[model samples]
Target: MTVLQSFPIPRPTTNPYLIMLGEALRRTPGVTVLNFSWKTALFGRYDVYHSHWPEILVGGRTPLRRLTRQALALMILIRLRLTRRPIVRTVHNVERPDGLTARESALLDVIDRQTTMRIRLNSTTRLPDGERFKTIPHGHYRDWFARYEPQEMQDGQIGYVGLIRRYKGVEGLVSAFRETEGRREGLTLRLGGNPSTSQLAASVASLADGDRRIELHLAYLSDAELVEIVTSSELVVLPYRFMHNSGGALAALSLNRPVLVPDNEVNRKLSDEVGSGWVHLFDGELTAESIITALDAAAVRADRPDLSARDWDRAGIEHADVYRAAIDAGHRR
Candidate 1:
């Protein structure tokens, strides 16, 4: 069984989740893995198509590029339907991406309708009516970063790393850290990752201005740099306005560091899965008190988060099972 992945294999800048999943799928018994390209997507031979971040297919930097990709996306959808190929889409985001054009939305609707199965990275994900789905915990990054030399963990160092976007609430994090008082003399906030826009970059910069305790690396972070950010921090805070399944949180845990995230059902469930004192949460809006409180909580935890459920080998087997089932059902349909 050949499974076509929507993303390419591991690269210096590839998302670690995709790289790990791709490697695991390749090792799975009776399964062959193929990385996606426009050519392979439209005309390649594969038994099951597994798509992650399908929106990327229709997104582009400019209007002309977007239009071209949207056309190809339409053609791909038509071919999949005509050939009766099954699509296994990973539900990475809870909703249709914000700021999508109407045509992109319609094309995504087609992809949703044609999907045979959806993979949820966490058990707490809620799908629309009548959508068939499976829960495959996003794999940990312990093995992925094993090659890098571990950075010495620093006390009172809180870090946030990954692509910085407005919805991620980086500015809020900076504000909270700035206002936090008492026992924070040793606390330093580290922010890393490229911003989505110049305005966002400036917003975070303005908030972080004159705060020597706050460090910003507003550029694409390589794997080694990411490892240093995660490993060195006593706690990693991801104050996203909306966070369902975060690779950042998992990466922090994989590196044996605790994390502070938004309080929600998904995060609550994650806390239970990982263990006590490993995943702390802040409710409502992120504030100075929440940041300080979560930091205090992370300081006392000495045990590692339990990530046995997220082993890449297990993820590979589970993905292969889903792919096989989707293929069988596709044939029947």
Candidate 2:
């Protein structure tokens, strides 16, 4: 059987899910994983059509192109349905980060009604309730990121690394860092990553201006730069207003570095399940006082969560089982 994944295949990516899952899927017998595109999907030759982040399937700038992609998606759906193939969806986010348009909303409606199998990367994901939902934990970045010997932390350097977004509480982190600088001594806050927009970058830049206590690398960081940013930190702070899952937190843990995350079920669970005094928590209002308290409470540990539970080989077997079941479901239909 063949499965077409709705993500860039055979392409180098920092995303651990693709790197690890792709590695494992390649090893799975009788399963062919192919790169997906509207053109390739038009051929209608796959047993299973799997997609993560459905928005990407219909991503476009012009309304005409968007509509065209939507029509293509419908055609693919129709072909799959008529061929009795399984259509699987992985709900990576509760809603699109950039919100949705009328066409995007309609696309999701059809997909929700037609999808034969749904994989929830997190059980608490905000997708609509359905019997089609299948819970699967996200794969870890430990292997792909190449676990390296952690260097000694210098001057309580706290860091945040990943795509800088508006809702990610970058502003709040900056404010808290400034407040911390006022109270704490000899500490620096380093933020590295390309911002969501040049405007947002400018806003953050203005806020960070004249502050020697904070350092910003507002660009797409290379692997070596990412390593330095993560390993040199005493603690990695991800003060997201909310979250479903975070590869950033997992990456920090893989490096045996403690992480301070917002107090939510997903983050708290990561702390409880895979912690060696590394996960620190802060509740609503990530104020400087609260941030300092969590930072002070955090302690470096020799032990960390063994991320082997997220290995792709085991996940691949489970995925294969799901595919076989989906294929059977198709046969029944």
Clashing pairs in 2: none
For candidate 2, the per-residue lDDT at 181 reads 69
* Model 2 TM-score relative to the real fold: 0.93
Model 1 C-alpha lDDT per residue in residues 1-333, reported as the tens digit of each score: 998899865677788788888889888899899998889989899888888888898999999999999999889888888888999999888887789989888888888889999999888888888888889999999998889997998988889999999889998999988987574678898899999999999999999999889899999998899999988998899999999889999988989899899999999998998888899999988888887888787777657888999988889999998998898888889
lDDT of 2 by residue, 1-333 (tens): 788887765554446576677678778887788877777787847788787778766667888888888888888877777787777887777776466788787877777676787777776776655556677788776766675555677657888998999878888899888887658888898899999899999998989999998999999887667778988887888889887778888878877678888888887777767755778888886788866766676654556666766777878877777777778887888
- Candidate 2 Cα outliers beyond 4 Å, as residue runs: 10-14, 97-99, 126-129, 147-150
Which one wins on lDDT? Answer: 1
| Highest-scoring model, TM-score | 1
lDDT of each: 0.89, 0.78
- In candidate 1, how many Å is residue 215 off? 1.8
